[model samples]
Target: MVRAPCCEKMGLKKGPWTPEEDKILISHIQKYGHSNWRALPKQAGLLRCGKSCRLRWINYLRPDIKRGNFTEEEEKTIIKLHEMLGNRWSAIAAKLPGRTDNEIKNVWHTHLKKKIKQKQDSNNQQLYVTVPKCDDLSVIDLSESDNSIIPALPGLIGSPGHSPMSPQPSSSDLSTVTETSGATAETDNIKVEKMDSSDMFFPLLDQDLWSEAELAENSSMELASDSMVAAGFYSNFPRIDDDNDMDFWYNLFVKAGDIEELL
Candidate 1:
């Protein structure tokens, strides 16, 4: 069955309702009640459609309809309800006493939407730390000045040539320290022995290991290969596998002032 249009009848009045029309609609509803909105206007002797008369009474001339600006609490309630209910204006209006769905919808478009957008933009903004660039690493100073280098590792402050008050060692000084340190030679011998025995010291950062396209195509195979390389490196230092154990050993070397022992 086809539904008849509400305003299909010809010669029916439309547009803004007059003060007299509002009075008649209010009085008619108060006396006879609006049991049937589709037949209300015809019975009340108004020159408007039943839909028009119904809107006039419910949206405008209802006795309990609240007027004037919405309060701060009401606006907050509308925001919360909108987040949960979305654009169901009628459902949102039911929570706010005497507030119409049309009024709440108008306020959302004109005012609330811009406020929400601004808050989201503020939250999404990224914070960047600016690091000063230096072309000459040899000329860089590490003194206790305003622009002094802050150590990232815990034991770097007490380490040789990396102290805040000491000047950084030159390339010649680094080579001399490497040649004289007995513990450094022992550590190197241990690494060489392991490489000869198991052949586990293959370069994990080789360019041919896995391309970006290959990684995207087969992530599981690439991950397994990467894990095997990582296991080989971790196997060399069984005691320093976790952060706490690593920190303990590093701090011990720093306190003893033996950089060679830390090698």
Candidate 2:
């Protein structure tokens, strides 16, 4: 069903209300209460529609109507109510005293919407972290080529100003020292060979010397056995004799701790 227009009559005033019209409407409503808004305009002798009169009274002419700028508390209440009630301006106005739905709706569109947007923008800015661009950064070289020796601190164990203790050698320094020591050992062995047995100290025997001597002795024995076999000295000897000899030497080395000590 379609509702009829507020004023179907030929002439009814519209637009901004005049002071004379306001005074008449106020006086009439004060004398006789507006029970029927459609008949109120005719009874009050005002040239306005029923809907126009109702809006004017509710939005402006009411005795309890607040006319000035909205307070901070009222603005906050409107914002909270708007979040809960959404675009229901009448429902939101019910919670605020002396405020009409039209006033609240106007304030929301004109002021509150912009304020909420600005607040949201400020919050979004706070959430983002500013990262420095790659071009702004500098590269640092911490490779061995840059500095071979890292100087000790003043309070540390091997620092120059503190103890007489030296800095620990690097891997390259250790390897160089080992090579120089090995060369000096070879030179000392040559010198020891020229010295007499009575004047010389016992030579330091390593596991490599024992292995080389054992290999040479085994090669000589194999050559002798091949020669004996060719001469037919042991015709009944099995081919497994060489294997038995190898097992015997391996077991002897296992039982005896070192070949150097046995020698």
Candidate 3:
């Protein structure tokens, strides 16, 4: 007899598993604990090779595995990680809980690349409208903060303190979030939410970025009956609400030249 490749006949998983294969693979592995992929087939009645079985288990069938398309944030993380790790998919995957290297790599190759292409198209349109080629720079000095125009962000990581805008260590960490304050409201019942890890550039999000006039213009609603601009309301910047949010805002401010410190 062909020995049937270990568990080929022992109800081992073979070929593309049906729903039954999924159930059996999951249940059997969970119960027995797949210590040995080579022997698992014989015992689990699966017909897949040990390597194939291992991949199926780790990449697809793991119970704790997170399944779904990567979010925009996750895409950023993967790009950042790829820049740091440089093709080390397995290492990149380790940092992200429930994420598989294969999945991260797939998203990089398929989705992120396309997104960058689209961003470039948008950038081309915005460049003409936002800044005309008059051979003179704007007073806001957005020269240093225009890097967001680039579609792919991986370069920011691997290049070591190099953004198209700045090579300084602080620029890499800070980016540009220049907001002009206008009118900030005073609400005793203020709300603060922790920012996400996805917010890479923060220190620049504080209301300080906005001028009093700008703040008033951007306010969602009047907080007080008299509508007076609150004292020190926006001044206490770098809210430390979340480092990431600060960074996110900083880049946005710099990109728009609304507050030119990043310039």
Candidate 4:
């Protein structure tokens, strides 16, 4: 159902409002207040639609309007508010003094959106390192593979005797998995299938890139998959063994008390 135009059949002026029109609209609004916008133009003696006059008054001609560039703080505020509120420009504008919804929407589209896209593209390119898996499939994303394999490292921590090849906690099982400050449950079910052990060691998540220095100082650490790998820690450690003696290796890498350190 298409609605009728605000002033389609009426010969009311449109486009940019001139100084004479601005003065007339301003004088009328100042004296009587904008109580009835649809009847304002005739009262103000301007041949313009009420919609156009109201938009002009609110967006540009308003006395408290801030007409210059947006400050850094304002830009950050807009971005943060947008993440929570989505494209509700009017609501965002309400938080920002002296900015109109139309102005904020324009800045978002014209400048800020492109800046955010470029930053995301740069991050995606940086995180995407490809490792050669086999002769058939030349390379795959390292981060993608981390989702399936456990990282082999010096400070690794996990539940001993749990096989790396054991399935990850399924979505249904996560509800049963709980965390306490310093307790490890046997039923936690975190496991790793022992690998050839010579394969590359990557951080389980992207954020584990903290320096071994930092890890040494801080005994308790949490791992995130989307984090970057720490510098110099990227080198592969000597493969502990090749035999199927899985329990011995699992114990060395994964101890119940310190498994959280593996991150």
**Per-residue CA lDDT of candidate 1, range 149-232, in tens?**
221223222234331111233433322111112334222211000012122222234433334344334444333323222222
Q: Evaluate residue 156 in candidate 2 and report its C-alpha lDDT on the 0 to 100 scale.
A: 22
Top-scoring candidate (lDDT): 4
Alpha carbon lDDT of each predicted model = 0.50, 0.51, 0.47, 0.52
Best by TM-score: 4
Worst 10 residues of 4 by lDDT: 224-233
Compose the digit string of candidate 2's lDDT tens values, residues 130-234. 222223322222122222111111112112222111232333322111111233422221100111223212233343433434444566444333222222223
TM-score of each: 0.48, 0.48, 0.44, 0.51
Model 3 C-alpha lDDT per residue in residues 1-263, reported as the tens digit of each score: 54555344554445675777667778988898988878776677766667667877888888779998777777777665654456788998998889998988888788865764554444333222221122332333222334333221221222342232211234333222222233132211111112222322323245555454543443331221011121122432333233343343333233323211111
In angstroms, the error of model 4 at 78 is 0.9
Candidate 4's TM-score reads 0.51
Of 1 and 4, which scores higher on TM-score?
Answer: 4
The digit string of per-residue lDDT tens for model 4 on 1-263 reads 99867885567787888899999999999999999988898899989888888899999999999999999788777776775567899999999999999999999899777765554343333222222232242222322444422222222232333323223343333221123334354433233322222332332433333344443332332121011121112221122222232332333334332222222
| lDDT, candidate 3, at 166 | 18
If both were scored by lDDT, which would come out higher, candidate 2 or candidate 3? 2
Q: Model 2 clash pairs?
A: none
Instruction: Give the CA lDDT, 0 to 100, for residue 216 in model 4.
Output: 38
Name the lDDT of candidate 1. Answer: 0.50
Once fitted onto the true fold, the runs of candidate 2 whose alpha carbons sit more than 4 angstroms away are: 1-4, 128-263
